[model samples]
Target: MPPLAIMPVLRFDPAAVAECISPLPPLEHTTLYENHNCSTSSTKVLYQIATHHYDNGVFEMKWGRVIIICAIVLSIQIASADTLNLTAGTYETFADNRTVQITANLTDSTGYPVNGTRVNFTTDLGNLSASYNYTNASGIATVNISSWDIGNATITAEAPTATNATVNMTFVVGPVSKIVLTSILEGTVNTTHLITATVYDKTAWEFANDENKWRIMPDVKLNFTITPPPGSTYNSANITPPSNTTNKSGITTAIVRLDKCAGTNGINVNVTNEDGVDVHESKTIIGVAGAPVNLSITANPYNVSANGIDTSQITGKVTDVFLNPIISTGSVRFNTSGNIITKPLDGTGEAAISIGPSIFTVNVTVNGTYLDEVGNSTNLTNETVVVFYTEEPARIVVTADATRISTTDIPGVNESAITAAVIDRWGHVLSNRSVNFSTTLGDLSSTTAITDANGQATTTLHSDITGDATVTASTLNDSGYEINGTIVIRIMNESFVSVITNIEPDPVEPGGIINVTTVISGQGNITGTRLAAHAMLALDRSGSMDPDYYAGTPLDVVLVLDRSGSMKFLGSGPEQPMTDAKTAAKVFMDNLVSNAQVGVVSFSSSSRIDTGLTLLHSSDNKTLVRGAIDGIYASGSTAIGDGLADANSMLVNGRGDARKITVLLTDGVCNAGSDRDCSNAIAIANANHITIYTIGLGSAEYIDEPLLQRIASETGGTYYNAPSSSELRAVYN
Candidate 1:
């Protein structure tokens, strides 16, 4: 670019220049434009002014946001009339050419309609064309939509210059219908399916005539596409449509896919029209989550049944590799070739369906799953299964050591070879079943010799002084059960005595009370069935003060002695000094159960309430109590509470019995509750339900002489005592 030259001149028209600073007589509003601040522009005011020419004269106006209105005309400003409003008729909209219209809404400052003004219109999305004609005196306009863009668009119109006023509008472009959804069905696997779609004009044209409109396409075809869930890959090639219908919807089905093996398919299709429209829609098909069948059992448990004189039992668990039940929702049945008690079917979890004696055959039939819930499995295997049962070694378990002692001193019997064997109801020895024998000596070292399948054995007795021996049988199974019972016989050398019978319900139900008693006895060891159990002993201290207290306990004894007024007559020595009687009484306490659990009670018109139950303990308490007993000189008459009401209550609450027992030595009859005839008291004692052995010691006192026998018989306890001094020296043992 070279040098350029420019020239400037000023020929001011006062009329024109003054008009810029002045205004027409004020109408509604006037817009002011001037060149007075030219110093900021570094130029003359006239040089800074902008000029616009109307049809005749030129005027000075400013470019700004203010709208200008002229109340009167200045010079020959050209004015022509144009329709301010226009309405056009509707037409059918095509995907391509959607029709449109335009008009100007114009007026003078006085609100009178004016025409001959130019108007411009446009849209936010594509191009728009409109006729820029002056409005023909109306104040309205109409416009039509014609476009393929499937989204929203805003249309606008405005007048010329900074005074331009524009109106915007939005219209719906569709009921986009060409995209259609259809269905197809297939069984499974590479199953090919054919689908058809007929693409039509999306716009419904209300205005049409017997003229050439959108007719059948020369060639209609559409491309098919599909998208799958993330991480769920699918093949696009399988969705390819036939070549015949190009750019149109025809055999346009998507193929259903299947994996040769397993899993789920969540797939859908995407269809695109010639007009660039896309549609989407999905389905889930399953192929491999089916049930499995065919369970086979290799072993048949024939040995579990009863055979001959030596019957037996079989135990073991059966399982599959997956640990799932082979018999599905239904059950399995078993049948044996021989034996009668044996059933044709047995439920799961049981080792056998027994056959008489021993012989058995393990046959199994596996039922199928509930078909109603799950359809039959094509992979189902064999229907029959085989189970195997085997018998373990049979043994007649004996629970006693080899030792013989005289039965003379034992309270329950006159024989010493006390032992028990655990066998079936039929007398056959059970394998791995246990037979244990224990005695009160607490040495309790003995067992019923383990027998062979023959089911017979001998158990030698271990040297436990004298008491009851027991046998318990139990299996070596989880939550294995047990059965127990007792037999009493004397052990070691001692003078024989009358029998004291004590029986107990061996193993009792949970929370059940056990009734035990010493039925009859002279001077002998306190032997009874429960002695074999690690027992807690209770002795009555009712005035039947005898020199022989608990001469019968073998293991440990918890003595609960009664101290009612009747004991006053049985006191040792003449005049029955409380101190001397209690002193002589200490001698009998020597024959205690092993770790003697000694508890004492004394009753009068008012009996001693609480007496701690524990061990003889050889502590300060034992000596003090012994002193107290020695100091206890009788004064009142016997109030034989009768039966063992209080004693029974104590045992029930104590519950401290491996084998619980009470030695109720009452010499006097029950006078307090005797009117009820010891019947209710006896019932209460019976309800004590626990075994009680009585020691009846008595003089000719009315309480002792009258009811003594009844108290002894009622509690299953021994009644013993010397109402005189001379008799007290004789040891009960």
Candidate 2:
């Protein structure tokens, strides 16, 4: 046989073979082993064994194959997968040259350390220690991240040849850099002031968007304090919630109460940061002065001697609602039965007045007032002090409330108060003394009366005469010496022609014409049977008895005129509405009583107060009012409501005791502003009891007839329509 090949198979062991050959001699036989038909089990494998032997020495070879079963012990292994994990020393860091450590941990799935693996690091912000870091024996890789800019940063670590093995983390970067403090006072010293503190952090994100914008630091702590000024105690200044945390907007608030006279205070705020940041801000807060509400008065000597040279000082102290001394510029005025001298108040809110050389027993009344920066006066309570003298009556003095009285028999119209004062030899008042009163004219309320605590006795004098009356008062002193005092009262004769008017309809509607009947009557001394006197039925519709009967009441009148563009359409001279309006206004002013006050307001799309209510008693004042009326120039659209409003304002500021009247003249409908409805003007006029007399100066087509009528009717006034400019004077009359 040339060669033999054997297929390996599981068979009996070679050790159990019947014949076993010893180790083959050199070159005697050749044996070869080859694995074949291996099984799935680890302990079993097929091997092909071949033997080579030589026949004789001819160099010819013969091959023999053998099948053997192998029982082998093998070492087995399973590969482990790589893993990557990222961690940070801290999630947050400040821009104050501080940093946070980022670590990358790499390992196998079997929890075995994977060393010598390079981890690639990347970040959205801040500086990194290294871009690539190798893992140590512990399978941990680390890098440091730091930034001067404040913002958020994203960090990543990745290993090569790993199944999507990448790890990421977020780092917050910020630091408190700046603080701003501000304050505003809402009212007086006792009121509260709102204090605002803003905290900020400069960051890269903020810079990228807007360099001027600051990155707000939320949840930051802050402390607020206020430093009081001079002449004020620390207790006078208090801030509530002194410690607070900022909101999401980076702002915090505190309330500060400063009760001081007047001065500048310091407001301070400090930022509290975890990174030990020392940020502070300060501002100046000016103190406010409170209103005067309390006043106390005292006298050096309760009683000053009547000796011609004795002096006493009266002092007045003022305080505010908080009981804090008023440190403002003002004075205390002193009034008394005698002469008084006044002086300005000192910084301590005390003002002094000196009274000396008393001639008789008299009481001194002292009062204090405060003048603010705007010169608004506030009056305080009044105090009284008496100057004493010897207690013996020596002189008697008498006074009358009115030296002139009307001859009419009216109770309040012709009555006068007569008073008598009794003094001692040393000018001391003597109370409980009997006084005798006698008058040459008029009737006395009492012939004798006892003096009161003030050493004064009062009596009433009723007169219907026209001549001067001398009243005498006499009293007996302690020494039985008669002291006499006399006063003169003049009762003048009354002469007037009253035109009694009667109206069929007691209440007439606005713009309605009616007939009135007049009857002339005379009182007092009428020389002839026929009396000639001019009469007018002009009456104030605002709570006034007919002027024809009660004619002495003072009047406050405001003339409102329309200077719209249409007024200029009628041309100049008598044909011009503006010219007629001026003329009619002047004529009405000329007819006003001497005691009447007049104010002028002109409107042309707007309104202006030409002059305030001025007394017509002086010719110069009357001339000024007339000049204002003449200066009006017509232009712009018509604003009737504005004219009425301006007129109402003027009347509201007028004398409270006078009859308020508004004469509004308009040539066109209200078409310029929202106030054209005239409802606001009407409401205000009615509330103030002011009568509005509306006069339509042009044709019906150019004027809002219903609006004018409504304004007048709603305000207890009358409305008149002037079809032509010539009729303006008649309408006003």
Candidate 3:
């Protein structure tokens, strides 16, 4: 008999289940336990009930006990594993009711196919053919899905009875159905127009009756192209954004711009579907002619003879606001007096006519009527005056394009166009005559030129010299009399005026006040009748002007020499003091410019003129000064006051416009004359605008240093002391 108690539930690791069940009897006669929710790595529980005993006929229930049993049953169910997996044939598809096949695979934890299992399907977007399906012999369940809406679709498959047996996959759905292109029908040439292509997608059949069946497709790439009208020489239509993506509104735009001529433009848009199929749409834009904004009339040989043999060409032109010629079908009607003629426009939108000379001046009017590519008509009118004259070569007139031009050596910089018109005594122009041109101070482009139909001959004159250029034109008439015409062109050079202002008392110090008279003078080659001049006076109080700042101005200088008895002594040098003084004086004279004048005054007991103010403008004048300096001798007591007075006299009567300067040298005090105090002489020098530079000769003890310094300082000059005769040359310099 078997034990009455039921078999205790036993737990074992899944890995050990095979080991624990191996002790059972042969499979045909063994009792088996099946687990409906077992995983590969999870713990499994087993329960068994037996009515018969083991081979020994004894009941045993213990760990690791041998089992003599019947068959064992196993049902696999993985923990958190995907046994029912859903997959699509294609991951992406168009929203135009495109169908995608989905397969759900069912398998056990041991990789054995699970047959006869039901799999249920669900989706977040789109539709499934069936909500529930059963696995076939291969453990695969299949279903069909479709969608009209553009979005991502999630498909889920689940085995309801199995533990953790569910799976889901995502599919992409987009739009690629049709495109509709739209644009304005009419547009002007040389203008931009907007063209739009609206894209849409197809939905499922269940939404066929609803307006939402068609959805907007975004981020779809589209390509645009343009086809010009037939018979066009060039394709003038341009499209911007040849390839673009659609916006959120499913609309893509392209700008089509027309240029030059009016014509029809065909716009095409192409889009490819996910399956590599291309769809196309087209629109036509008519480029029409704009309104005739401008009309013009012209006549060649405006001055024509009354003789019928001479003819003039009259042309009329039509243009749009954009300056494009309107070449469409059009006729120009030209009216002169009571006579009228009609002519068709050429390809350039211009019509021309030939008219004979009239007795009286003729005024011609033209009217134009044209049609654009769209059959719209525009009318415009323009008028021009024509001069008709009798033929003869009588009176001649000459004129210049520029009467005054700056002088330049460059070929085109200074040029004047000279034209000569030959006319009859009745004021009628004559044609086909040869004329000769001549200029006084410039070169002519051509010496001779033939008159055109307008009875005018032109020549270009170029000059590099500044002066009046007299141009003459001469021609022979029918009567063999020479007809001459003359005109003048002034070739001017650049000129500027300079105004110099000088104050009578120059360089007023920081705190000194004195009456000053400013003398202003203007000098240059600028001449004009009744031309008033303006000048400004500016004084620089810095007193840092260079000695040569006035180098260009003529300078008058006087040399005051000391011929006292002490100067005759030979002191500290190989040469006598008198000799050194003479040598230094000559050196100073040599340093002056040719425009500078020099005078010499020698004083002992009294002062006497050795040479009057003489300019060294020539070698002969310089020789005279050198001779006077060499003839000087030292003698008698020094009378510096008398010497200064004599030097001032020479300068005061000298060149009125020259700068007055005096260089005085003395070795002794002013002890020989009543003017010894030298105050009177100093005052006279200052009043005369004279600058005095004084040098004390010999040693400091023998020279009157204070008197020399006073003389220099009082007259805005400098003082120097020569300790020896060797320094006399440098001191003078």
My TM-score estimates for the predictions, one after another, are 0.29, 0.31, 0.32
> Which portions of model 2 miss their true places by more than 4 Å?
1-85, 90-98, 106-120, 130-139, 147-152, 156-166, 172-181, 189-213, 217-287, 299-314, 334-342, 352-733
User: Over the stretch 192-242, how does candidate 3's per-residue lDDT look in tens digits?
Assistant: 988888787654234557756666678889999987766655567789999
lDDT of 2: 0.69
Report the lDDT tens digits of candidate 1 across residue range 1-733. 2221322112234454344324433322333433333212322222222223232133433222222232222342322222233322322333444565544566644456644445655567544655243434653333444564444445555544214443343343333334333544322333444444433344323223422332222244445543322333333224544222524322244444443233344445444544466643344444331232333322334233333322222222222332322222322222222101111112342222221232222233322211212323232222334332334323224332213344433444433343344455433344334455544443333554453343333334444345444433323322454455554433545643443334344322222344555433333444433332333233222112221354344222223334555454444445443333344456555445324544444544433322334444332234333433332323343444532455555556653433445554444545454433545656665775555554445446533443555655666655565555455436234
Q: CA lDDT, every prediction? A: 0.39, 0.69, 0.70
Model with the higher lDDT, candidate 1 or 2: 2
- Who is ahead in lDDT, 1 or 3? 3
Candidate 2 residue 13 Cα shift, in angstroms, is: 46
Model 3 TM-score, 2 decimals: 0.32
- The 10-residue segment of model 1 with minimum total lDDT is 337-346
The clash count of every prediction, one per candidate, is: 99, 1, 8
Task: Rank the candidate models, highest lDDT first.
Answer: 3, 2, 1
In candidate 2 the C-alpha lDDT for residue 282 amounts to: 85
